[model samples]
Target: MYKIITDGSCDLSTERAQELDVLVVPFYVSTDGINHQKEIVELGIRDFYQFMIDNPKVFPKTSMPSIQDYLDVFGPLAKDGIDIICICITTKFSGSYNSAMNAKNMLTDEFPDVKIEVIDATVNTVLQGMLVEEAVAYKQMGATFEETVAYINKIKISGRIFFTIGGMDYLVHGGRVGKLSGIAAGALGIKPLILLKEGEIFNNGLTRGRKKSKQKIVEQIINIS
Candidate 1:
């Protein structure tokens, strides 16, 4: 049987991953000098978000999975002769794709017969989740490997994502926003509409409030569709 693999950045919960027969390799999140594996974390999504809010002084830094982490998952699958389709976070956002590719190269000599395809998702969170779901569906429906790859590539270009941040502090800490802009937005209750373009994140525009920001995102999607 073939296997679908993705990293923690895909926004799929562990339970959902299991249900879809997808293997989720974890990424690391560091807060207060403690590294937490996102996949095995005890906190749920809501709690994690809350934790971020409660601990404003501690800005969490996320890191891509290591080469060894990819090897640990791919090695056994290769040994078992299971073909793999690994969809990783965008190269612009993280190094997970590179690590997965390196792992594939390392194992190629040992498992010459194993087929491993690593794809750069060029997106993250729910967007990548959607792509992974489509890939799993196509694989289950017996689409050829080349056909599946082609479908993902087509969808990747067509996909558009728009979102508004809850707090500008996170963006400022991550260097996505200037400190002055973040401070001004926070004081004025302004939320910026952000989007992913060509694997990089960008701020599209600003809304006065969170509700308006969300509405603007919906309208943008409707207009584009």
Candidate 2:
């Protein structure tokens, strides 16, 4: 049998993970001003989103998991004769992909016969989760590991995610936007359309107000959908 591994960046819900029997390796999110660190999954999405809202000054920074964390998950599953295929966030976006690869190499050395394949999702959030769901479906249909992997890569290319953020303050603090742009938007009360491309944040444009911002987001989603 094959077991699946993925990271918190996929934004897969807890219920979905449980139902799919997917193992989630968490990534750490930290704030510069506060020592309190949280995993993306440990803090529920609603709570995490609210935290981001309330503590706009924190400037969230994300970190990849330690290799030991991966070994702990992969080593035992390998020992138990279950092959592992880990789907990770894009290397372009996070070091978590590299971390998963390193863990795969280490697991190969320790459990030479146990198969470990690390897939680059190339996209994150619910899209990645959808890819995982497809993989799970393939497995259930008795597709080989190689076939399941191929399906995931194809899905990665076609998937898309788009949204808008009301606050540019966080993006500016995270160095994603220039101070001048953020300040000007604050002065003018403009909201920016945010698009997720290649698993990272990209600015679409500024909107005059929240209603326009939301309408723009809806249009973007309709176009993409």
Candidate 3:
């Protein structure tokens, strides 16, 4: 059987995660000087999101799961004689992809019998989740681990992501945008319609306000499709 894995950055919920029978290697959520790399299933999404909202200043920072974390999940499956395929967020988004790859290589030395493959979906959020969801269904239908990984690669190449940030604070803080751009945008209340292309976010354009920004998103999607 094929065992699937992803990290918290994918934003997959517990119920959906369980239904898919995928292992989530969580990323760290450090806030208020506390740090944890626990499972998202354990943290609870509603409460976590609420915590972020309640303490807006305490922006949660995420980090890749440690190598031991990957070993813990992969070891059990290796013992069970299952092949592993870990679909990860874009390396461009986080270092998680490289971490998983390095861990998988080390595990192979210990469990030569178990096959481990890692695919960088080159996407994040719902777009990444959609590929993972499809991979789960394919595995359920008896697709070999290699086959599912190949399918995910195909989907990744065509993935479409459109996003509207309520504010550019996160992007600016993350260094995804220039300080001047963020300040200018805030001054004009500009909403940028962004698309993730080739593992980097590019501004599709900007709009005057929230309503127009949303409408512009709709228009862009229509034109693309």
Q: Compare the candidates by lDDT and give the number of the best one.
A: 1
How many clashes (backbone N, Cα, C below 3 Å) per candidate? 0, 0, 0
- Candidate 1 regions off by >4 Å? 41-46
Worst 10 residues of 3 by lDDT: 30-39
Q: Candidate 3, residues 1-225: lDDT per residue as tens digits? A: 768898877788988898888888887766645766364845766677898788766677767788888888888888898889998888888888888888888888888988898888888888888888999988888888788988888878878787787887888887888999999988899998999966888879889888899998888888888
The TM-score values for the models, in the order shown, are: 0.93, 0.88, 0.93
User: Per-model C-alpha lDDT, please?
Assistant: 0.85, 0.81, 0.83
Candidates sorted by lDDT, best first: 1, 3, 2
lDDT of 2 by residue, 195-225 (tens): 7766666778778888899999989989878
What would the per-residue lDDT of candidate 1 be over residues 113-220, giving only the tens digit for each residue? 888899988898899999999998998899977788888888888777888877887788878779998898899999999888568888788899889999999998
